[model samples]
Target: MESQAAFNYQQQVEEIRLAMGCDFVALALVQSEERHFQIRWEFASGNLSQRFRRIVLHSGKGVAGIVFKTGKPIFVPDAHQYYKKEDMYNYPILIAEELESFAAIPLFKYNRVKGILLAGCRKQKCMSIEKFELLQSLVTPTFGPYYSEEVTGI
Candidate 1:
């Protein structure tokens, strides 16, 4: 049943990618058993390679890990401008997946981060703030277990 659920989750992610017309989309989920706070890219769409499937991310390590820890969305229009090449290795999924621009959004279940959803392009500056906002709008009210925590603006 667990495996089936994971499979279903992957399918949903693919559906989201197609619906959004995104260049690429991937999801990284934490294991339910909590044996370790390890994260892995469980699903991908529009992939150039399958290398990301094997990479495991620790908390506060990469894009997903940072979003997972902070419970905030991360939008990078140009990875080269925002992150150094030396720091790229920390986000093995990005390097392995060959992503140059991306956004990482936290998925919440019961007010806690349960996973991360990453949408990206292989070219620099391919994503924009408008697209990011639209993506956020699209994912907020629905998209399964992922929910943004309510924030009260000052």
Candidate 2:
């Protein structure tokens, strides 16, 4: 798969954020072998922190990590209710982005999970099921080199 240009990535994420009425939209990509396959938040829209650029995600460690590990999307209509206050700390993106509702989908290339697309809002129930479904649908046959037809989170 061809790598996405930074400008294109930014534009796409920004479009998604606006279309979906999300407070934040981000893409996390797996690093090359030289970087030891770490996952880092690469492109973002509506973000409040620069921490994502420096944080590397491990499999099963966080929202992006869970999606990367499971190859399925995780949608939480209410992050505050779904995750305990203390346990929510484990999900760095939620805290870092101040997300209250969110979902994540795995981006696959060659049958391997290569990236993650996450959308979120800082308000409760802001990421409705319909919206989440729309996001998933929008991703199909598009989203850089990834196709939703060939992959789904859950």
Candidate 3:
């Protein structure tokens, strides 16, 4: 059952990457409580290598971490401009993927961020505001088992 779910997620990630015309797309999911809710890049499409699997992040650490911690979406038109060369190590995913531009959104569950969805390109300024906005609209109310936005009571 778990494998099936992962397969479905992989397909969805690939579809999103294709739809967004990105060079790479990935999903970072929160591990179970046993792992202290650590986040890991579980699925990816159009990746340059398998380095992303080795990355495990705590909230507020990397790109996934920051988005997970803040529960807010982020768009970087130029990774180099947004992050200094000396500070590139802070965003391992971007470095691993060699992404020049990217955007990521928090995936919610039970009003809490449980995952992250990221889309990126290798060319500088390729991820424009319009592209980021389109990615936002694609997620809408939900993305797989997680909600794209936090759910609140009236």
**Candidate number achieving the greatest TM-score relative to the actual structure:** 3
Write down the worst ten-residue block by lDDT for model 3.
Answer: 1-10
For model 2 the local lDDT of residue 133 reads 89
Per-residue alpha-carbon lDDT of candidate 3 for residues 1-154, written as tens digits (9 for 90 to 100): 4335443778888888898899999999988889987999999999999999999999899999999989999999988888999999989998999999999999887788988999999999999999898788777533645768787774
Per-residue error for 17 in candidate 1, Å, reads: 1.9
Candidate 3, which segments miss by more than 4 Å at Cα?
1-7, 140-142
- True lDDT of residue 9, candidate 3: 78
* Of 1 and 2, the candidate ranking higher by TM-score: 2
lDDT of 2 by residue, 1-154 (tens): 2554333778888988898989999999987778877889999999997987877888888998898888889999998789999898788889898999998888887778888999999999999999888789777544756754343464
Candidate 3's error at 4, in angstroms?
Answer: 10
TM-score of candidate 1 against the unseen true structure = 0.85
Model 1 per-residue lDDT tens digits across residues 13-113: 67777766678888888776555888888888888888888888778988888998888999999899988888888878778778888888887776778
- In candidate 2, stretches whose alpha carbon ends up further than 4 angstroms from where it belongs are 1-7, 149-154
Which pairs clash inside model 2?
A: 72-153, 73-153, 73-154, 140-148
* lDDT of every predicted structure (CA atoms): 0.79, 0.84, 0.89
Per-candidate total of colliding backbone pairs: 0, 4, 0
